[model samples]
Target chain A: MTSVADTLDVLDQAGKWRAAGKGVALATVIVTWGSSPRPVGSRLAIDDGGNMVGSVSGGCIEGAVVKEALAAISDGKPRLLDFGVTDEQAWDVGLACGGKVQVFVEKVE
Target chain B: MKLDTLHALATARTARQPVVRATRLADGAEALIYADRTEGALSTDGAIVAAARRALADGRSTTVEIAGGMVFLHTQTPASRLIVVGAVHIAQALAPMASMLEFDVTVIDPRRSFASDARFPAVRVLQDWPDDGLNAVGVDAATAVVTLTHDPKLDDPALEVALRSEAFYVGSLGSKRTHAKRRERLLAAGITDAQFARIQGPVGLSIGAKSPAEIAVSILAQIIEVRARRAEALQAAA
Candidate 1:
């Protein structure tokens, strides 16, 4: 679980990125099932160029979430993405422990 | 993405104030709410603000149904604070352990030799009288005050202040007999039975703690127990 201070730090960075005219996307763990690495309410912020801060899955599904976050930034739309061990490619994405996480990615305007 | 709201939240976090961030799930509208006031524009309704305030008091994040939509209230509290009222041997062990547990620790002692940076390298050491030092730090519900000095001159004054404060935990190191005598003295000094009951005499969980380090562990365990129980109660209420 991310500490409250760490979540605030990510939010502060997102604000800074938005102020700097950089497109920013915020991905938050909205739900978790089984033995997910990160708990619900963890957040990750991604800038236009894929620069990111914080973690939603403790390295288990950050890459996938960041990809979706960058996509949300470009499309200027929100996306709810779910990843779990049931997927065929789960081992490649590091979620092979029967855990599932639902992330909400939204553009920070 | 409101910079003003984020900045205000950051400032509150820096000031160690309990605050909550309420975000509308549908549109992502955000607001910063404290006990008495709110910043930004999530909603102007009193119900939303009141829910946010309740979340802040509970110290937990939860999704609450409001009039128009569901809002997620993320409550943030300052780091837990531990104020050791004596720069003693047990403090030497306790400070680091508490720091590792994310407590902002302060060790106070009137004796300069004991309350030196040399003794507590990375901790805040205050060279002042016990009451004066605690007064300067200011205890609240998030703070735990531990008096390690057995001296009545130091520990008694510190206890007098701590028992009256809103600190979640107030503990003093002494034997049962010592605590009984100390209790008599405090009663003579006008401390009531109810107020004196708030203190954890013998200072720690009875886990056969012998060494200073072991005693520190026991004390920290007891503090954690109290803290966890409080959180559970709050969760139940929420």
Candidate 2:
């Protein structure tokens, strides 16, 4: 319920940010496999100023997603990012439960 | 995401309408897919729209490899709800538990004291008559209704309303003998046997639950089982 409401908030605020001349990027978790903190379709929105709403993997990988989302907002390029426990940097930002998540970060036009 | 697509999503959310946003992974092309209409760059793709419909029904996001490219269908559906018709002792245990499980829970009873916010600290409490409370809440396919009041006067009205609505689950707490008597009364009130059969009597799974908390656990488990079975059947048919 909180996730759904969070997404609703993201959509609503994204529109406001876009209208107010602020760049915004939306990141969505498209795939999740095993023990993921958030389910598939969870979202996180990042503004040009680094403000964020909603979550993709709760707290596990949001920092990385926000970084990529800010880059997407800057470059106007969409990115399909993947994070798993198997990655070399997994120790730094990997899921504690060893789940895999695929996120699509796209600039909101 | 285009401005119009975002607006359409906000519109769909407000209406509680199911939606799927299908994104082509090859390019960043996306489409807002509703049952009757579509918008965005890839709106003309029939295969993607069909897949989107399937994902919407399944209430799951999926990645499908189509002929041209892989597409991710992200689905959004209304939240599931739980309506406890009697703010009784069992409901005191059930309401918060259901809320914790992410069901929008509401406790309804004509007795003000029973349905007070003090009784149900977190869940919504409605002191309206059972039927009126149900009407105010508005039952839907994503909703589950449970009649926890053992009194026929209170439970039967709620049961009659629930049995007629599109609520996915309807259960009433009572003994076998009490259920038999209730069945007769409902039958006399013009409720068909088919409709009456929808009520799960002596509510909750027979897990030898002794206390109110255990009974609440059993009931919630049964609701989850029923919903999962229904979803499996729907997906199989689809």
Candidate 3:
């Protein structure tokens, strides 16, 4: 889950998105393996308009996850997604070791 | 923001999202519109609003901050559940403690007398065999499984299933002698030494706890400690 500070920041962002009439989905990392940057409980919130908040899987794969979350909301299908940053491309997400993560993204509705 | 009613209405519209409202409990709370609001109290309005805004923005959980005190608004995000495969005395106490920690606790036992609601009023007590109940609930990393029944017939099959699942913490309550027997049985069942290590036999902390409540406390303490350590390690790795 995101921190109180981070949660508030994302909520503020979500509020703005809501005022602008954007649909938002929240993604939470429920599990991780092998030197993952973020804890299993880390969270990320993405709006239908592509605005984002929170992080899961450190910085390695949040971009991709956010895209998936936005798409899930638009499509009205919640999904559990997984991504891995391997040692060969460890620097791709600025991760040192090969780490894999599983995230659950669902629409608030 | 000065209009509590307007602010409450605005927040209620977005209540579907995990929202936390930090309001000044000591002062400046006159602007708080919802008397039904779950509050995070802070000393000042600035700090309270800042904290409340932060919790709202994250859409993960909520926190309310007061100057000297902070009340965290934990929006009820679904957390992992825990299933105990025994209705032993320790399970009686452990179930409630686990529930208090926010785990959806369920106890399974084939003995109707052992798994009664009166014994564990707060927990979901099921008078069924282990495998059936666990399969129904679906154990995973989010779920913690513990076998408190010393009987091999009760614990063995349940443990076998738990070993195959992604349950983060799988422990059994027993003595050294019982664990040795269990190890031998697991080996016969094709479990490797590595997999055998997965079971936290002789469950609970090293603290010498004699009573059922004490044992429950120790066991829950270990779970909390392990979870906290895992979170820290993940953060450091990040």
Candidate 4:
């Protein structure tokens, strides 16, 4: 489980990125099924430059999520993404734990 | 997400108050909802505020469909606290173990020699009577009180305060006969039998714990079991 300090750090980083005029997006693990690495409510904050804090999926699909988060930042729209081990590219990203995860990515306005 | 609202959320977290942050998915508008009041864009709407309040009461973060869009309510509750009312050997072991479990631990003892910082390095040590120490610390629902002194003068006063408060766990260290006598004293002191039943005498899981460290492990294990079971029940109800 993530400590309160960790959660605060993610929020603090998002605030700092926004203050610096950097486009920011927040990705949260809204739902998890089976043996997903991170629990529901885990967060990852990403800035325009792809700098990020925290983790929504313990490094398994973070790269894909970050790519989507950057798109959300540009469009100022929220996107809900679903990923599972059944996907053909799951083995390439290391999400072979036979679990499904849904992440919500939104611009931190 | 206004800077003022963010500041208020940080302040509430520092003060250990239950607070919820509701973020609207459509426009990214945010609100800070406290037990008494709310601050920000979503504060004025009764429906959103009520939903946030329900999330806070559930002590979990969740998404709810509102009028215009879906809002994610991130509920943050205060950290769990464990007050060990006796700076004894078991407490020395128990305090650190409890800290590892993410509990804010405080060791209390009236004896200056025992309650010294040297004994409880990196732990909050209170050199005062049990009742006074507990009062200063302030017991609440997220708190657990354990008396290890085995002395009536020390353990009884602490139990009196703990039994009356909303502490989730109240434990006392003693054998069955000792607990029997302690029960009589508590009954005479106006503690009802129903309330007295809350005290876990011989305080620790019966793991045949022989050493102080082993006993501390057992006690911490029991506390975790109780907390997990309570959370499971809450989840089931929710």
Q: Which candidate should be chosen as best, given TM-score against the real structure? A: 4
| Predicted candidate 2 versus true structure: per-residue lDDT over B57-160, tens digit per residue | 77889998888777889897876889998889999889878876767788999898787887787777889888899999999999999999898888888888
Assess the local accuracy of residue B118 in candidate 4 as a C-alpha lDDT between 0 and 100: 86
Q: Write the per-residue lDDT of candidate 1 for residues B1-238, one digit (tens) a residue.
A: 4556667767887699888877776777788888777777777478877777776777766677888776777777897899999899999999988877768789999999899988888778899999999999999888999999899999999999998899999999999999999999999988899999999998999999999999999999999999999889878977
Interface RMSD of predicted model 3:
17.4
Q: Name every residue pair that clashes in candidate 1.
A: none
Docking quality (DockQ) for each candidate? 0.22, 0.33, 0.02, 0.23
RMSD of each candidate relative to the true structure: 4.7, 4.4, 17.9, 4.3
Task: Return the candidate ranking by lDDT, descending.
Answer: 2, 4, 1, 3
- Cα lDDT computed for each candidate against the true fold: 0.84, 0.86, 0.67, 0.85
lDDT of 1 by residue, A69-104 (tens): 888888877777778887655677888668987777
Q: Model 2's lDDT to the true fold?
A: 0.86
Q: Where does candidate 2 clash, by residue pair?
A: none
Which of 1 and 4 is ahead in TM-score? 4
CAPRI-wise, candidate 2 is acceptable
* Per-residue lDDT of model 3, residues B1-238, tens digit only: 1223224434554342334433222222323312234432233345555554544444334334455543333232335578999998989888877866767688999998899887877667888789888988788766788899899998998998888888878889999999999999988998788888988879989899999999999888888877667656655665
Q: Report the C-alpha lDDT of model 4 over B1-238, residue by residue, as the tens digit.
A: 4556656765776699988888776666778878887777763478877877887777778888877787878787887899999999999889877876768788999999999998888678999999999999999988999999989999999999999999999999999999999999999999999999999888989999989999999999888888888888887988
For each candidate, what is chain B's TM-score? 0.86, 0.86, 0.69, 0.87
lDDT of 2 at B234: 82
